[model samples]
Target chain A: MSYGFVAPYTALVIAFGVLPALYAVFLAFTDNEGGFAGIANFTKVVSDFRFLPAVAHVALYLVIWLVALVVLVSFLAVVVHAVRVRWLSRTLRFVFYLPGALAGASSVLLWLFVLDPTASPVSGLLHLLGFSSFVQVIVPANLPPVFAIIAFWTGAGGWIVIMYGALNNISPDVIEAARIDGATAVQIARRIQLPMLRKWISYMGIMSLAAGTQLFVEPQLLSQASNAIVPNDYSLNQLAYQYAFQQNDFNGAAAISLLLLVIALALSAVFVTRGGLFEKD
Target chain B: MTTVDVGRPARRRNPARRRNSVSGWSMRTIIAVVVAIFVLFFVIPIVWLLLATTKSAHALIVDNPFQPGSFGDLAANWDQLFGFQDGAVTSWVGNSALYALGALVITLVASIPAGYAMALTEFRFRRLLLVLTLIVMLIPNTALVLPIFLELNVVGLIGSPLSVILPMAFFPFGVYLTYIYFNTSVPRDLLAAARLDGCTEFQVFTRVALPLAAPIVALVAFFSFVQNWNNFFLPFVMLPSSEGYPIQVGLTSLLASTPAFNPSSAGAQSVQLPTLALATVISVLPVLIVFLFAQRFLVAGMTAGGTKE
Candidate 1:
């Protein structure tokens, strides 16, 4: 009976998840004619002119994105939770979570206009920063921060919601006890709540880091808007796509993707083992 | 700490608590200020988007971006937007609904049962299956999209709706969430009692357990729906034709046609900034509605990851 219940999902997972992953490994190590090419594909992809820049771009974006997501999301979640009024707290959460509805491609397209100083609602701020046009705002040096802002706009709210829920899950009795011991709200928040949220913070960090590495839609679209001002291979995923479809270098694409998969899996493995992500009660 | 203990006899603890409360009031003020700034950061862009739809392309640049334009301009923009490619926007919306809802059904059917069996039953390879689900869930979906595309290409399913829907329906996170929910919340004794009452395993699940899993069902459904609807990479890769484009992918096409952004590519039917903004608003409306209605389930889904009941 259990097998009957589990069969459908298992079939799909094998077909979609397991098979594709294995297929990627095969493609990465093979030449175009199905002959084993060893690590030639990996070396070629790593040595591509765009490879180092793509890696650097993704690394820079991930660092900024992950740090902002961790710091700001946690701060907002903690602050919103501390609000005494029930309705006020609920409102704050709702407002914070509102932007999450605009994930991925839609948000990216919308942000093109937001980054345009002429049409931006916050043009005053843009003017203060001395950016007068969309092109000026989205210069190469600004792409990482630009992508980070777009990501944070659509991503941070969900984390705040998750963090707030984790905050709520903490036992109020423990907090009450702390308050009775002469701990200020700030002290209690730091010493008590934040410590309890360590696992969750790490969980957020790991998940966000994984997502941050897959920065495709933002840069891909920006490349179109900027007329190749943002390089076509501005991210690793874009580079992989270029290799696969644009260049018809499936082996190279597969090798790059495998490298990414290894990075993601290795980092997640570290977090899973160290963070006790699968701890049983 | 010593001072507080020593002053307990002098009734000084009350003053200390009072002092803490005073500081707490100041802390609240600072938090409010910070939260308000964040609120502006989030709200202003959306507000600009909504207001942009009411203006002409020229006015959107020249006028105050926050100001609402005339109703006539909004009507004109709406007409121009809906009029694009003889109402391609409508077809994109339909495509998005079809893909999202189709995947949503499969996700619910597959994930719920798989999660239930894993969490509640001692089946062979259950631990292995759970571990596989976690690993897949942890691996970002985009990382798998290209590989999945390759596999689908070999099978000649590329550009088919199944190419998008089938891959999307394989939502490992939903299964993990369901597994977590059933493991933590559902009572095994209740199932055991149902079995004693002459219920088969299937009956125990269908009648006794499934009803109790409504919140989780809604949570999984909402997430699956949102993920499927907001999905861009999968559909963008799968559908080679604009005719099959979902709204999210369609929005990119619209962005390219907007004269302000891509003047070299713009033609007679090029999109205006206001029309483009309206298209964006239209694309987001369904997700926004679902989010508002499923707010309760959303909170449940958000909390499910790292916390126990």
Candidate 2:
């Protein structure tokens, strides 16, 4: 009876995560060329011209992204914490979060305008900086930061709200003592407040790290705008998609997808352990 | 006290002085500027999208692109969007409803049980299951698209709604949510008592835990629905027919003909931009309405079952 109670979910997890994972690993080995060709496909994936570039794409994006997120979101959380402007802050957070409310495909379409050169609101700023062509505004080398701008635009505001919620959890008494000790608001915040929010920071970092590596939509949209100069397959997953759909090599697609899975798994492991996801928070 | 600790005290003092010098105004102003910069970065594109729908395709390309053109052709645009390629876009909306709703049901049924099982029972391989679920949660949405598409193709469900729906139902986040609910909220002692009173295990779950789990169930349903509703990649690949495209995919296919994000996509019949924005607006309304009503539950759901019940 207990077994029956648990069976369906167990089956579902195995069906979705576990079995798919095993098959993905299997896919990393076999190839259309020789059928179960062993390390040949894995080697090709490693040596593919786009392989390191794709990793570089996400890495540069992640650095800018992680720094921007930590600084901006923390600032948003702290200010909202200080002002006690309850309704206004909540409404502002929601407005900021609205971009995320637009699904990725929609948001990408919207972002093209921000990145567009002529007659766009951003045109003046880009002109001031001497980037006249929209293509110049986002050369192949600059695509990472451009997408980071777009991804952060759509996603980061909600994170501010999440961090603020964690900030609320800090005990008022500890805050009061820091205040009574003649600590400046900055001192109180750095010493007493931000320290307490470390768990949320760690959680946010890991989640961002995991999500950052698999960057897609912005690149996909970029490819659409850039006349194939930006290979839609600039990200690993995009590479997988092109391989499967355009190239029709399910096995190669699976191999790349599996590599992505391993990266995600390893990151999750680090997070679940270091982030203390289920521990006392 | 005058003979303060040598190294540590000096380090603390330096940081404190710097921090104190950083007044709230500068911080607020700078942060606000940073946020405004991001806001403009995000807002411009959406505003451009809004303006795009107001023009004819010719005007959209030839005229001042950013300026909103006359609404003289709004009706004509709408007619083309709805009637273009023989009402193909409207069919996409119907298909989306069918797939999202189907996925929502499966997500609820599958996730609740999975969450419950992980939370309540001390089963073997449970720790591994927990770890694996976290991993699945992190896999980018589009990463598995190809593999799943291929699998469905081999099994011959590629063009059917089942390709999307079956995959969507297997919601890892929902499972984690349910597990958290069980772990934190459901009192173990109550379950033991129910068992002692001759209540079957199934009875204990349904009678006690299920009622309180409503918020999470609703959360899972909302998430699954919105994901399927907004999804582009899965339907783009798996469904061969336009009849199976979701609203997002349909909107995108419509937008492809227009430059970048222009609403006036070129077809046998010309369409305009505002209709596309209107279509975008229409596609988003259902999710927004659901979200506005359901957001109160989100905070509770995210925090719930994961920590103190």
Candidate 3:
């Protein structure tokens, strides 16, 4: 009976999730002719001229994005939670989450105009910063911060909402006890509320780190918008894509993906175990 | 979960309340100002995008970016957008709806029962299955897209709609959500009671457990819909033809045709800024509408993973 209930989904996961993952591992270890090539694919992928830069770009972008998500989403969620007016708090959450509707590919598409100094609503601000065209704003040096901003615009709001909910779950009795002990609102927030949120904060960090490592759509579209001024291989995922499609190197593509899969799964395992993500009370 | 106070205003105005050493009024002002500033940062881009549809391409670049253009220009942009590739925008939207809805059905049917079984039943290898789901859930879909594409190609399923739908339906997050919901919320003794009353396990699930799972179902459904609707990479890799493109992929073609982005590719059939912006607005409208109506479920879905007991 239990198997009857679970079989359909398990089958799909095995077919789609487990099979493709195993296939990637197999492809990574084999050459084009299907003979065993061992670590050659991994070595070849790493030796590619574009590999290191793609790694650096993704690393830089991940740091910026993860830090911003932690600091800003927590700050906004705490502040929004503090709002006394119900309607105002709800409205703030709503507005913050509005960008989430235009996520990924679409958000990146819309932001081309936003970053274009000639057509942006904040063109005056752009001009003040000495960016006169879209190209100036989307330079390789600026891609990390630029992608971070687009990501935060569409992604951070969901975190804020999640963080706000976590905040709401804090017992009133504990806060009241702190207040009775002469803790100020600031002290309560810093020492009490923030401490209680440690589990949630770590959860956010691990998850965001995983997601940030897979940054593809933003840079891919930006590379297109900039006429490939931003390198075609601006991210690791894009590199994997180029290997598979452009160079017809499935083994290299599979190797890059397997490397990424290992990192993501390892991080998740650490968090799930140490962070008590699935622990029953 | 503990019920926290929301700091109601009426309670703050009470004379008996202890005055803080720090100035509370000034703190309130700072928080309000900071939140307001962030709000402006978020709203400005969307407002500009919305207003861009009303302006001509020339005016969009020349005039004040915030200035509203005439409805006439908006209508003209609309006409041009729908007229492109003989009304391809409508077809792309239709395709998105079909794919999203199709995948959503599979997600619901698969995730709900699987979650129930994992959370409630004593099954062999349940722990293994749960761990696999978590690992698969964490593995970014982009990383899997290429491998899945290769797999589909081997079976000659590439370029077929099933190529897109089958992969998107493999939503582990939904299973995780339903699992959590049943584990934390559903009462075990109640199931036991039903079982003792001569109801079969499946019957107990369908009658007693499933009805109580409505909120979780809605939460899972909304998330599945949003994810399926917004997914770009899977469909982009699988379907090579432009006619099979969803709106998200179709927007890329529109972007390439815009001379502002692609000067070399622009021809007589090039997309102008206004029409391009209009098309973007059209693409996002369905999700926006669903979001407005489903805010409650959206909140539940976002918070589900974080607020565990």
Candidate 4:
């Protein structure tokens, strides 16, 4: 009966999720003409000129994204918790979350207008910074950080909420006891809360790393919007997308995807071992 | 879970304790400034989006970009957006609704029961199932698109709605959340009592557990809906025609035709910035509205996996 209850979801997972992943692994070893090439496709994909640069671009973007997200979300969560003002905290959470409501493509498009100096609401700030054009604003040196900002805008709020929930789960008795022992709010956050949040933060870090490596929509759409001046092969996922869709190299795409899957699997291993995500409660 | 007692003694001492522990004025000022900056960071782009929708393309480029334009201009922008490609925006919106809702139903039906079974039953390969779900949940959706596309193509389902809907239904995060919910919140004693009363396992779940799982159900439904609705890569790869696009993909096509994004497009002359902004606004409105209404459940859903018993 219990097996019967689990049957439908298991079937769906096997059919759609597991089977496709296995198929992807199989496809990665085969050539375009369906010949089993025995790692030739992997070798070719790794040596593709755009592959290394795309990897480097995503690596830089991930650093900026991880740092900004952790700092901002932790800071906001601590401050919002300390303030203890109900309405203010709720409103801030909602406002931060508003961008998440416009998550995938919409957030990317919104940032395009925001980054365009002539069409942006922050045009005054852009002028002050000596950015008179979209090209000036989105220069090569600024692309990673700019992408980080966009990703942060759309991604940070949900993490903030999760961090806040973690903070809330901390027994107030511990906080009160610390307060009685003359610990300031900052000290309490640094000494107690931050240490307590180690697991959640690790979880955040691992998940963000996995997601950041697959950065696609923002860079892809930005490249499209900027008339390809932004470089269409701006990230690993985009490179895979380009190979599969544009060049009709499905094998190369599968190989690149397999690389990303390995990375994801490595990160998940780290998360499970270090973050204790699946420990028996 | 010790509820922080903030009633009499703690409330009476909090102000004094706060002042003594931290310089109240300076700390308050610092918090205010930091929060204000973050608020502006989050709010400015959205506010700009709203204001940008009201202006003409020329005004969007030439006028004070932050300032509001007339409702008359807004109406004109609406007309241009609806009039583009002979009302294709409407079809895109309808397609999005159909796909999102269809996937939402399937996700709820499949994920909820699966989660319930994992939590409540001693099943074969239970640990394997749980671990697999976590791993699949962690893998980026984009990574699977190529293989799913190939599979769909092999089956001649490319350009069909099932290509999108069927894949969207396999939401592992939903299953994980529901698993956590049932594991932590649904008591074992209740199920045992139902079993003692001669209820079968399915009957215990349906009659006893389902009613108590409303919050988790809502949480799963809201997330699955948003994910399916905002999903771009899968549909973009699977659905080949503009006629089948969800609003997110359709907006990209509109962007391709807009002069602001693509100067070389022949349709660029007809599509304007305001119209594009309006299309963006229209595309996101449903998710925003859902978020506004179902935020309580969303917050609960997002945090469910984080909290340990």
Candidate 5:
């Protein structure tokens, strides 16, 4: 009876999620003609000039994104929690969360304007930093962190809301006891709240690791807007996309996607083994 | 630490607690400043979009970018935006609503029952299903886009609404959110009582569980809508015609035409900056309106898995 209830989404998941994933893996091993080419596709993709640079670009982006998300989100959550002014906290949360509503393409488009030195409201600050044009602001070397800032602008709030909820989950009795014992707010945050947030921080880390490796939209939009001043295949997913759609190299695209899937699986494995995401009561 | 303990006997702790309550002036100032910076970080770009929509193309290039332009220019911008390609922007908005709402209904129907089964039932492969859901939830949606594209192509469904709507309906995160909500909030005793009273499993789920699942249903609906509405990659890849394009995908074509983002485009002269900004505003208006109305549910859905009951 319960199986009946589970069947619909299970069918959907298999058709949409699992079967495609397996098909992607299967396609990765084949040549364009449907014959098995073994590791040739993988080796060819790795040797492509864009491959290592794309990997490096995403590696750097993942680092910045994960670090900024964790540090900034946790810090803001604590600070917002400490402020304790009812309206201010709610308003701040609402403002922070506003960008989340603008996630995906719209936020990326908005940041195009924000980063365009000529049209940006922050043009004064951009000029102070020695960037006088859109191209200068999004140089190849600056793209990762620039994308990180944009990612943070739209992405951080959702995580902040998550971490803030985690912060509020701390039992009031524990906090009351700490307060009665004369622990300062910082001490409470540092010694108590931060430790309590370990599970959530790990979850964020693993999830961000997975998501950051698939970085596509920001660099894609930047490259598109800047007319490829930023490299078109600046990240792994964009490379995979270009391989599939642009070059009609489905095998190569599948290979690159399989590599990403392996990384995702590896990260999930590590998270399950070490991060306690699915710990049973 | 020793100082506080030793001084406790000589002085009352109430002053210290009171001090804690009011924090120091310096800390308050710092908190206020940091919050303001964060607020600006989020607000400035959106505010810039709003202000830019009110300006003419000439004013956008020459005048203070931050300064608000007159409302008359907003109407002019609206005219240009709507006038482009005989009101393609309205068609895009309509397509977005149709696709998003259609996918949202499917998401609710599929996710809620699946979550109910996972949370309330002891079944074969339940643990496996949960783990699979978690892993799929974590896999970036973009990673699946190409493979799903290939799948849809094989089925000859590419460029059809089902290509976008069907794929979007399989929202793993929504399923997971519903799972967490049902697992935490719904009591087993109630289900057991229904079962003991000879209610069939389907009847129990339909009558008892469904009524109690409103908040989560709303939560899942809000998330599914936002996700489907904001989704760019899938629809961008799937839909073949401009008419089938959702607003998010449509915005890119609009961006390509705008001179500010693409200077050498053929439509650059005709697609003014304010008109493009107004298009951006219109594309986001549905989401902004949904958010304004359903923010509580969005928040609850977003943070549902974070807190352990």
Candidate 6:
């Protein structure tokens, strides 16, 4: 029976997880430039045009996504803990998490309408201010940030909900004791409550890190509204995509994906071992 | 595993002086302002989606937006969406449901038993097995997309629904969740007592542990279902044929192909923006409905392992 239970999980991991991971890594080392050229694929991936920009795009996205989630979740969590309005707090948490349920493609589509100058109400306001064309509202340089805004709209809520749940882990008496010590609300939170929740915050950060690196869905969809102007090889995942899907270069795609995997694994290992990602300190 | 740490509240302090402080008022004002801005950002997209779907492709851009509700235009636009490409979107939705439901069933069967075995049995390599699961979880799902596709291609299962569904079924998150839930939530002493009563291990698990695993059963079901249902990338890659496309992919393909489907502003990209908007609106309805029913279970069940018990 134990073997029976293990059978399905084992088969799946081997067929879909372990085998693929090993095969992809091996593929990355090969030069399947139309056919096999052995180790040339890895060399090409490292030296490819737009490689640095791809890395930079992911780096920039990570910085913005992590900062936004940390700042927003912590702030909202602090406010909820201070106010203690049960129903209102629950409602707000619901509103924040609802966006997460929407898929990335859907969120991107939603933003396209909101950003459309001719139809958007804000664009109407912009028109009244003599800014008619979308070019007035957004330019090429600011486009990635606009995509990041769409991501935050859909993701920041789930983190805030996580923070709320984490805050509940803090004992009520502790907050009261800090109050008795004449510590201000800000002082109590920063000095007392915040320290207690560091492990959770770390886990969220690490999880966010893994998520931020996989920035394919947003950029892919956004490129449509932006008229494919977001640069086809803008991010590593997108570059891999354009290679495999657009150019039919599966070897190059596998190569870049392996690089992404290494980066993700390194970050996740740090959290898993020391940041209390799955256990209490 | 029951912590039962109900620390009492600190003693009362005077309240009259607290209400008059400027810091309190200003902080409240700041919070209110932030809430207003953030909530508006959240609300606008959904409202725009709803409103955009209600208007015809032409009226969406040409008209002065946000007029009173047009039940007529919504019905008409939906009729066109389904009838647009001979109702392909409906087939896509059906395909998505089949894949998500298939994966969800397999995830439950595989993960629940794995969780139970990991928690209860004194099996060899338990620690090694646990570490393996953790490492697997760390390996980002997207990074493995290429390798999985290759594996499927080698086995010639690329276009099959099983290609996507089989992969989605191995949810490490679900396994880890069950591990933690079983570790903390269940009464291990009850199992020991059942053994003392001459009950076999399987009987103890089936009779006592399984029934009490209610909350987690629901939690895993919801997460597994949602992840599979909302998944776009794997299906997009595996199912080369549009016939096997899920709703999310179907919607995206429709959005991508919309400019040709409609001739509005053939010269400009902005003209077809509402097509994308309508696709977004239709994609979220199922998840939203499922979430409303399952959210309470999600919150309570999540509190166990996710927050370190």
The candidate with the higher TM-score, 2 or 6, is 6
**After best superposition, candidate 5 residue A49: deviation in angstroms?**
0.8
C-alpha lDDT (0 to 100) for residue A120 of candidate 1 = 81
- Model 5 agreement with the true structure over B106-181: per-residue lDDT tens digits: 8888999999899988998998888888778767777788888877877899999999999999998888987887
- Leading candidate by lDDT: 1
lDDT of 6 by residue, B1-309 (tens): 232232222222446445535676897798879987787777766766778777776787777676543878777666666764677878988898899899999999888878877776666666666766776776667777877887678789989989999999989778777888788778778889998999876788788888988878888898888888888778878888888899887866666665622333354332244545666677788887887776565565444445443
Alpha carbon deviation, residue B54, candidate 4 (Å): 2.0
DockQ, per model, reads 0.68, 0.34, 0.67, 0.66, 0.62, 0.54
Cα lDDT tens digits, model 3, A22-136, are 9999999999999999999999989999999999999998899888888888889888887789998999998898899998688998889888887888889899999998888
Candidate 6 Cα misplacement greater than 4 A, ranges: A33-39, A124-131, A134-139, A279-281, B1-20, B62-65, B193-202, B260-276, B300-303, B306-309
lDDT (tens digit, per residue) of candidate 3 on B158-179: 8989999999999998999899
- Lowest-scoring 10 consecutive residues by lDDT in candidate 5 chain B? B300-309
DockQ, model 6, C-alpha based: 0.54
Estimate the TM-score of every prediction.
0.94, 0.86, 0.93, 0.93, 0.92, 0.89
- Each prediction's Cα RMSD? 2.8, 5.3, 4.3, 4.0, 3.3, 5.0
Instruction: Specify the poorest-scoring 10-residue window by lDDT in model 1 chain B.
Output: B300-309
> Model 4 segments beyond 4 Å from truth?
A279-281, B1-28, B196-200, B266-269, B307-309
Tens digits of per-residue lDDT, candidate 2, B155-183, equal 78878778888877777777777777677
Tens digits of per-residue lDDT for model 4, A146-212: 9899989988888787788888889999999997676877889999999988777878888889888
Q: Rank the candidates by DockQ, best first.
A: 1, 3, 4, 5, 6, 2
Candidate 6 lDDT, tens digit per residue, A1-281?
A: 56665667777777776788888877777655445667777788779878887787778777877787777778877776666678877777777777777866777766656665777756766677676655454555565577678878887776676667778777889887777566777788799777877776777787778877888776666565455656667778878877787877778888888888888788777766765556421
Model 4 lDDT tens row, B42-114 = 9988888999899988889888767899999999999889888898999999999999999889888898989
Task: Please say which candidate is ahead in TM-score: 1 or 3.
Answer: 1
Indicate the residue-level lDDT of B214 in model 5: 90
In model 3, the Cα lDDT at residue B212 comes to 98
Q: Is candidate 3 or candidate 5 better by lDDT?
A: 3
What docking grade applies to model 5? medium
Q: Give each model's whole-structure lDDT.
A: 0.87, 0.71, 0.86, 0.85, 0.84, 0.73
